[model samples]
Target: MSLPLPATGTKRADRHWWQTACIYQIYPASFKDSNGDGFGDLPGIISKIDHLKSLGVNAVWLSPCYESPNVDGGYDISNYRKIDPRYGTVADIELLIRSLDEVNIRLIMDLVVNHTSDQHEWFRESRSSKTNAKRDWYIWRKGKSITIGNECVRTPPNNWKSQFQGSAWEYDAHTDEYYLHLFAAQQPDLN
Candidate 1:
């Protein structure tokens, strides 16, 4: 798509268009269901563009609709470049963007770069071994061994608590190390 031209006679110091845009946030799963599949999809969102226009929405802040395990309400993204089948396909997203653009509405997709699903290829390879090329892509640390009830137990590297409760680090038996997750263990923190 071509870059939007700046408004005529608008000074650089002036507030940008987005500074005053009326953005409407949409969580696809709970917004509208187009196929009766019990989940909202991109097509369903497209079907409501008229309603959004009537509501004077100048932009849409779409929540993550990327391929995910839905462990944290689709925040555990398994793939960053692909759309989840539960929502729709890449074409659907393209159409949505184009449709929104046609009506002078901007599309803002929510991207979660802080962490990725443990099922993601990057995380999988990172946890494969300490020497894996992508290993440094995530935060991994050795745990402190403590004696507990006659048996040696490995505790998290630090006393950091996860937002979802419990230790923020999850021990990986394969690599004999712990990976940090600020949220759920399924969503490992990316370095």
Candidate 2:
């Protein structure tokens, strides 16, 4: 069957919009501010939908707005279900999605699951005790001892460096083990 062609000469069915769509990345905190709060909010994004459309953007990939400590610029999520107050309320996000939908613009959110905030419930429970049921959720390796100028010092399990320019593993005194953190010490890598 022949697919209908739009004014842009692109077939509706033959062309996957996701493959050809102009998607813009919006870091909400650095974007427009409608409430003069010095931080971008959902209403700010809503007001800029028209500007994005004018710029030929059909989709937007939004940065993390989830509840976090902002250790990694909101990438270390503490609660995936809750929206950070600095960004907006849950209802505000819903409104933003609906407003974008009205203008035929798709909204996408960033999903960072490589590691979560140490304050996250799962991480907290996992680190509560070595025998905890969720202890295996995060990688915990035995620390190694290295002599530095005749002084023996406990070191991480490996010589790997974190992306943030530090040891990839953090020593947890409570658990007496070194947990892998590809990013920040607060972000332990999930097992």
Candidate 3:
């Protein structure tokens, strides 16, 4: 089933720029590495503004480059406000934005909010204790306990599976609870 296209000769101002923009996705880790660190960084991206413009790119969707433990390829961000040191600093990102703006190219960041790195301050506090002030920020449950052969064992909160495979819940011995993780064990789902 084909959808009807917009009427020809429609005024450009009548539609959102994104409706007809040429967007390019850049995985900063694999893009140009300006520092020779073997990983792409913001400065590297900034250095390619001319290349992006020459490619007729109107927008760039940058993958996550937030501070993380790299357990989930930066998707498990430890800090949402800070850029990973390996990728450069916040100032570098600001420069990248301005550079892209110079070429009329928009910048879109891949912000992962559904879950955060286990090392994230919020997640760390949430997992510290059941009564932690931020405990409710993440999904936690007391999994069922089963007796097997004379030993008692705790199982996951449920039989749900993770997208990356195995159980979706990780057992926290400190809190004696199972936290939900849709992706990696290090990434717990936000409440």
Per-residue alpha-carbon lDDT of candidate 3 for residues 1-191, written as tens digits (9 for 90 to 100) = 96566689988887678878899999999999998879998999999999999999999999999999999889999999999999999999999998899889999999998999999999989989998999999999999989999999888878999999999999998998999999999999999
Which one wins by lDDT: 1 or 3? 1
Order of all candidates by lDDT, from best down to worst? 1, 3, 2
Could you arrange the candidates by TM-score from highest to lowest? Answer: 3, 1, 2
* Residue lDDT tens for model 1, 72-113: 988999999999999999999999999999998999999999
List the pairs of residues colliding in candidate 2: none
Q: Summarize candidate 2's per-residue lDDT along 1-191 as a digit string, tens digits.
A: 97655557666676778767999999989998888989987788988889998999999999999999999899899999999999889999999999999989999999898999999999999999999999999999999888999899998888999999889988889989988899999998889
Runs in model 1 deviating more than 4 A are 1-13, 148-150
- TM-score of decoy 2: 0.88
Better of 2 and 3 by lDDT: 3
- The TM-score leader among the candidates is 3
TM-score of 3: 0.92
Better of 1 and 2 by lDDT: 1
In model 3, what lDDT does residue 104 have? 93
Per-prediction CA RMSD (Å)? 5.0, 5.1, 2.8
User: Which residue pairs in candidate 1 collide?
Assistant: none
